[model samples]
Target: MKGIQSTGPALLMLAILILAPAFAEPAPNTIKIVCTTSVLMDPATYIGGDRVEAITIADPTLCPHLQGDIIPSRIQLNMDFIPGADLFMAYNDSNDQRYNIPAVNDFMKANNYGSVTWKTVSDPSREWNTPAKAKLLAEEVRGWLVQYDPINESYYDERYGEYVKSFDAIEPTPAEKEKLNQTQVIVMLWQREPVEEWLGMNVVNIFAPEFALNGTRTAAKVVDDINANPEKYRNVSFIIENMQSGELAKGIEESLKDKGINVKRVVFTNFPRSIEGVDTMAEVLEHNKQIVL
Candidate 1:
């Protein structure tokens, strides 16, 4: 009887041990991805599928480039999360949307957590703001996921195919392409340069904001250019603005319409419109297409 009682408890304990993992959250062997910016997290989530746990150094609520401005408190919080990451992906838009990672690296060093070798992407042929670039980056992300978790290679590729197809629908239609081909545009901000190529529009000039020109005579002289040669800027059907640089639009609106230029003054967000939306790249790109077209 004592043998039976002892064995009964042991068997029960054994059963509990075996069942514990079945009810556990997040299965073992899941890849941990740490993205330098939240904008990159969208694509990483899609490509990682359910096998990845993604952490973004930059949160979705902030602007893309502003990710570098995360406060000291947030940095300490990240110290708890980043040490376990298996892969680190960083975007290298040194000209337009640079990210600062030295602080993150230093934290890892202080905590004795090894610093991950970062994989970077600088889209030299096309900028990251457009759908085409998003599609290209998705492929790169898929490759990274596959490299780390080769067992789920097929799964990642399947998700990537769907992601690419979704963006394919966002491309300009034939008629829209023809219209864009004929129209010339002047974007007031340097960050908006990709819109010109993405929409097939001729970008005559991309004006960089000289902060010194705020309410200065130089600003007036530039405004005079739009007023004096309305015909020269007639084909300028879109005065696309950066969401970050609303000041550039200050006095240009009246001059742009001196000849009834009828331009669509559009604003573009550098980051995903909604971070929680799993298909953020598709949603943001499609939103831009609907507005621009």
Candidate 2:
């Protein structure tokens, strides 16, 4: 009788414990990533697919590289947002968004918030914004996921392979040869050689601030860039303002216009987003293609 009584009670307890989880809500397995620059937003999404949720803090409408002192509003980016992430990455190349990095790293050190420590990782290389660079970003994202969630490596690899294949299939319009009305090149506040190659344009340049603040590029070394008398400087057809730095682009256009070079103007976003309904990394490139052509 005593054995039966004890055994029955134990069995009841095991049943309750086993059934408890079924009644309780299951935790979600999706990864959460926060990217500081708009440039990184689409790449994370393209590589992560359904497995990830990414938020970008930077704007596609303004310069991502604004000096902290020059832009007071940007210093207020909420640090609290970093704690909820599975991964946090900020672009260190171009304007690199360096001012925001310290705040993120400090929050990580204090909270140890995510699975990985975010050091000052930057790509000064031209690959950061172009589709050609996206393949590399996808590979990196897969490696990070596999390292942290080994069970999902196959899943991650499968998706990434699909992503890379599409990039391989892309056929940008062939390089333009004639430099008739001064050839056109995409301007990035500076040269983005990759974007130039992607657009098949002949030249690209970034605006030096001395022109904006001091009222002209004539005193600036950019003077040589405008002097088409030299063959190397001839093909700069227009100014394609980086999304973040359109103000700079407008100012540069005016400055250049003042100097007799009438450059065509277009705006380019650094990443994919809601604009023109573009939601995919590949679509982002396609959007640029449409814009450049």
Please give each candidate's TM-score.
0.76, 0.67
Q: What ranges in model 1 sit over 4 Å off?
A: 1-26, 59-68, 71-73, 95-99, 122-126, 182-184, 189-193, 211-224, 244-247, 258-260, 274-279
Instruction: Report the C-alpha lDDT of model 1 over 6-42, residue by residue, as the tens digit.
Output: 9999999999999998888855577778776666787
Index of the highest-lDDT prediction: 1
Candidate 2: tens digits of C-alpha lDDT, residues 87-171: 7766565454465565455556666654446522434454555667767776666677677678767877887788788765654
Angstrom error at residue 151, model 1: 1.4
| Residue pairs with backbone overlap in model 2 | 62-244, 63-244, 183-237, 189-206, 189-207, 190-206
